[model samples]
Target chain A: MALWKNGAFVDDAWREIAEGEDPPPAGHVILPLDWWEQERDAFEGSNAPLGLRVAPGVPIERFARDINRFALIELVFPKFGDGRAFSMARLLRERHGFRGELRATGDVLIDQIQMMARCGFDTFQISDATTERLLRERGAPAYKRFYQPGATPEAPVDSRPWARRPG
Target chain B: MYRYDEFDAAFVADRVSAFRDQVSRRLSGDMTEEQFRPHRLMNGLYLQLHAYMLRVAVPYGTLNARQMHKLAHIARVYDKGFGHFTTRQNIQYNWPALSDVPAILDELASVEMHAIQTSGNCIRNVTADHFAGAAADEIEDPRPYAEILRQWSSIHPEFTFLPRKFKIAVNGADWDRAAIQVHDIGYQIVRNEAGEVGFAVYVGGGLGRTPMIARKLRDFLPKADLLAYTQAIVRVYNLEGRRDNKYKARIKILVHEKGVDPMREAVEAEFAAASREFISLPASEIARIKSYFAPPALQARAACDAYEARRQTDPRFAAFAANNVHPHRVAGHGVVTISLKPIGGVPGDATAAQMDAVADLAARYGHDEIRVSHEQNLVLPHVALDDLPAIYDELAANGLATANAGLISDIIACPGLDYCALATARSIPIAQRISERFGEGERARDIGELKIKISGCINACGHHHVGHIGILGLERKGVETYQITLGGSGDETCSLGTLTGPGFSSEEVVDAIERIVNVYMSVRTDRSEDFLAAYRRVGMQPFKEALYETSKGADI
Candidate 1:
């Protein structure tokens, strides 16, 4: 899988461990939510950075208490049209106040990257070659006007006087 | 009419460019059809049975003369010389080449219009009362709030890929002209005893294979909390609405299964937890939007001698005045509905020439404004009472003065198998036949206010579920069969129609409708009762016996 971050494809430093695999003692690692929940105490002494991979429809509220333990949280979209991850992303950032890097993985199309970014995903895992190529070339088009605020800071107040947000 | 600011213009231009690029990618095979389908639908391009159909948003059905002229140009240049006005108060062009859609989007943007969210799973166009600013009984102009919702819902990042499409309607008048009860979300602009304006919010109402009346969610929501409250509701549905079954994916099903109380609790909890400051509108912004929709300048005057003389002299003009002209907020002005449903004509289909005429009339005598009604008619919302004769003459010249605004012949019919891919049978032909059967002026006027709605299929695009006389066409054993339903209403007293009995073949359906109407005519207490009121009083047994008992007796 290719990782895209900060508007370009980049080499991923975090290694995702499968359910049965053992975690390294000192490297950055990502683990599935179920696996991490079952084996979280085993990595107590390790100083390695931890990340959680959450599948779509998994209640993010369940992990809210332990949210600060991870450096990154990856939200999965099992398919292109399933939007459960979007609400989860917003909840994680806005409601839980998770300041960690949020990533989107699985079925990440070029057309949806901007919305994913707006909903608080800082990184995307692009598996489709066409999407990857398109992102590498033209980049996502940014709309100049937004009517609602999201995880992205949209306003200190513009000329249009509705819902002007303060930091 | 809300004019696009520089930011709004830039937003639409960017979207057009993005769509152009997406179309280019599809042409080059860089994107597959499955991947491109949602993108195209988001821009209101649908691949119908024969060709591509492009649905354009007429936001809250308010348009200026220039925009109407642009639509006429699009119909003449890009489509098949005519456009179909939809029940949602939008317009659809039945034919357009796939390669030409990007250019069409560019044309639409030039007029400050785009098809964004007109289709797809995202929130569709926000509709409002067609007589919003002009209605005498309106509590407030609903278009301002509709425009606010339109902007907030446009390309809404989180709600775009929802489980199913969403529809919202706002009613400002006491009469419920916009059919708020049958929408996914309905807002009734109301005033409290404290004299503060707010909304009575309704949720989870829709018409489709499973019809539902929206339940009241909030007795009164402050005007400022509109966006924030709506966001919370959509967010909850995005997370919890069923995705397994396409047929049961609407918010109605979610509300049905979870029950209204639980759904309300969930939405209220979400609303309570949401950052309301970032989403709800400030008072200044509401005033700013409201200014754009301020009622036109009109001064009340004494009755015009010319208008009185014309009405007294010409029977046609008198009929037009009685049927077509509606009471405006101002005494000297009136609301005129220009019917697209001509006798023996396809419902809602307006030729390019007729569109240009409407635009011209709007510019000259209608306060430079036009409104497309959800009932598939164009409304001149601010017409001078004295100008009725001239306007009627102009409309007659253009074949638009039908004088059947709420009469029996004014039918709502969706483009069924003739154009739609999902339709099981043809709807336009049935509508045409019914209108022809009831074309006689005195007969139709005698029949009085009967709303006949025909849907090509159970999707209810024609809103057959809420029609006073509803016809649902289906395919059975390789033949077209239609089911009739009665007493459905889309007004303030909203109710879903009950099926009269078994289905009839396409050939027998029109006759069945006549039989039903004949029964209504015989059993009605008087002409004052109308079809729905009479049906309510007499019940379906009379009509059912008139239909099936006679057929059973024939068999015997």
Candidate 2:
């Protein structure tokens, strides 16, 4: 497994705790949604950075109030075709105003990285080594001209009022 | 008729290069078939039963002579020397090798065309009335708005992965030539009491396993809010449409389940929240696109005496002039429909030579503009009446002169089991057989505007649900069978056809159609009443009784 952040592969410091496992004492750690729901008080004032891994079918609104408390949010894809996480990412960034690191994990592919990036996923955890290498080398072969305005505030460069302005 | 600017050109080039890379990765085993299927489909490449089928979009059914010529060239070079014009205003090559797809796309890009979003769950090609600018009754041309939609929907990031494919159609006339009511989103251009242009929007109409007629969502939406309103509807559908089952994933299903009122409320809420600065089109941009679709300047001329004399003398020319020519907004011009459904031939297939000849004819007399109708025919939308004789002669020589534009022989059919993996039975052969049964020119003219649409399966790709005589083909007990429906129409007064009786075998289906036609002819009050008119006047009882009794060996 490789973790890509801010345009390059980097070390993954966060340890994702399995079910029924004790929380780590020192370093940053991520807890599954169910475990975090059951044990919300244990990580109230920890020094290490707190992260949450939100899976599909877990109502994102349940964590709306506490979204600012976490430093990182890992949105799981489960499969590339199941795109519930993409919507979740947009909601977290646009609606909830989560200014923390938004990461995409599980079954992320090279072809989908551009769209994932547009949906506000700043970091990606890819299990496939070949896809990781491709992303590291070419950085998602995407069109520079876009048609839709996404979570980002930048206007499309081809059409509309913003494009007509003098540089 | 909108030509691509530099931005549009570079955008299409970028898409082609990206698809080229995707194809290379698929061939090199970097991506599995499961992963590559959606990507290729987004590029309009489908793995059909025999080979890869490529559907090239003709935006809003408009094309120029150069584009048509390039299509003919592609057919000659990469395909099987022929192409099938589809009901979605696209041309599909039934036999293209996967390896040659990139080259084919490169060829298309030369002519300012690409197959983006032609088959994916994203917004497909935005279709409009075939006779948009040339129609005598049009309030305004819908192509400019359709072009705006084409640009907006192309490569939309959030909408590319929708639950199911989405279709939008626009019509600028009161007669509904574009079949607007049966699309996912139907926009009918209208003028308010104060003489301001806007749109009457309809939502949720579709045909598949579950057929539905769209309901009016808004009586009038201002023209400036077109893109913003549409974006809101799509956003709501993307967030709420069911993804558990592919069959029930269309926005029509979601609209049906949620009811129209709730759906409208949700869409309105989304529309209210959408940022106007990001979604609304500027007036300058609208004017820029509208300038491209302005009708060509013409020197008005009187009716040609020579053409009238020829029509009076030549029976074949008279028949063609009667059925194939449509009224044009310009006085001396007419819209000529080039029938792809020649008697006993495939419904929409045209050879490369035929395509080239049509292009030549269009360049000579039709202002270099062509259109592909949803009925699977081509149109020279701006042909001068004086040049009809020469155009007809060239079309006759090239096997493109079938004078059955709205007659019984102009049947609509899907590429069924013969080509499509989703079809249960063959539809093209059935259409061919029906056309042959009523091949007589006089009888076809007398039958008068009978639209027989056929679909091979429940998907209703051929729009069988809205045909005057709809045919559904299914396999029953190791044999192909067809069920008939009556009195369906895809017009302003749209209605789903009713099933007449039990299914019939392929061999018996044509004769059954003959019996139904005979019943209509006998019971019709006068010659002026067409088949659909008579069917609507008298309900389905007489036709149903006649069909079942004829099957039981009853006398006329």
lDDT of 1 by residue, B300-372 (tens): 8678777889999999899888889899989878899999999999999999999999999999999899999
Largest DockQ belongs to which candidate? Answer: 1
Q: TM-score of the A chain in candidate 2?
A: 0.87
Q: Write the per-residue lDDT of candidate 2 for residues B1-556, one digit (tens) a residue.
A: 7887787888889888888888998899988888789789989999899988999999999989999999999999999899999999999998988889999999999999999899978899999999999999999999999988888788776677787899999999988999988999999999999998889999999999999999899989988899989988987787788888999998899899999999999899878865677667777888888889999997667767767888989999999999999988888788999999999999989999999999999899989999999999999999888899999999999999999999899999999999999999999999999999897399999888899999999999999999999999999877999999999898889899999989999999999999999999999988899888999999998888877864454552
TM-score of 1: 0.97
DockQ, candidate 1, comes to: 0.64
Off by over 4 Å in 2: A21-28, A31-49, A55-63, A152-167, B550-556
Candidate 1 local Cα displacement, residue B135, angstroms: 0.7
How close is every model to the real structure, measured as TM-score? Answer: 0.97, 0.94
For candidate 2, the TM-score is 0.94
**Interface RMSD, model 1, angstroms:** 1.7
Off by over 4 Å in 1: A43-47, A161-167, B550-556
Top lDDT prediction, candidate number: 1
